[model samples]
Target: MSESKRMDPFTGEKVEVDGVYENEAGQEEELHRGDAFPADLILGNTEWKLTEMSFDNHHEGRTDERLVPKEKDIDKQGKIDSPRRQMDRGKK
Candidate 1:
């Protein structure tokens, strides 16, 4: 007989279901967005186990902005040494 493979819940792709992995705290470790299919079977007390695998195009839903939450806003005012900050004391 042949065994059927299950799909990954997050990616909706066919994946091979394996045994559960644990962590130091005995809690289940979460899979990140960029995590690859057929995750590594990590052993610890947190119960982190590689559940399944995913397709190549799994991160279609994630937005570019989401990947980089915030960026340094450019200063449009220019440098402080510019004429803007200089006081016109001579005119007074």
Candidate 2:
């Protein structure tokens, strides 16, 4: 049998391909290209492996600003405001 393509993706990493990914716990998630891998609430960070490729041709390889990663915003204090940090701003 041919070797299966395996990916080493971590939480917060950009999804390089549109496909179904399986984590170490055997949990599967369908992620589109350019989307960030989400952290597992219970397991925290886990490695992801691409299991299946998506054949959807709706976009036809077109790039979307909403789907791609954005530049980090810097606050007045010169601190980079990441998505997680922005969400935690009011908690502190």
Highest lDDT among the candidates is held by which one? 2
The model with the greatest TM-score is: 2
Residue 14 accuracy (lDDT) in model 1: 33
Question: What is the lDDT, from 0 to 100, of the residue 82 in candidate 1?
Answer: 51
Worst 10 residues of 2 by lDDT: 73-82
Write candidate 1's Cα lDDT for 15-62 as tens digits: 234334233434444444544333333531122336444444547856
Write the residue-wise lDDT of candidate 2 on 7-40 in tens digits. 4889889999999998888899999989998888
Off by over 4 Å in 2: 1-7, 57-92
TM per candidate: 0.17, 0.53
What is the lDDT for 28 in model 2?
Answer: 97
Q: How far is candidate 1 from the true structure (C-alpha RMSD, Å)?
A: 17.8
Cα error, candidate 2, residue 85 (Å): 60
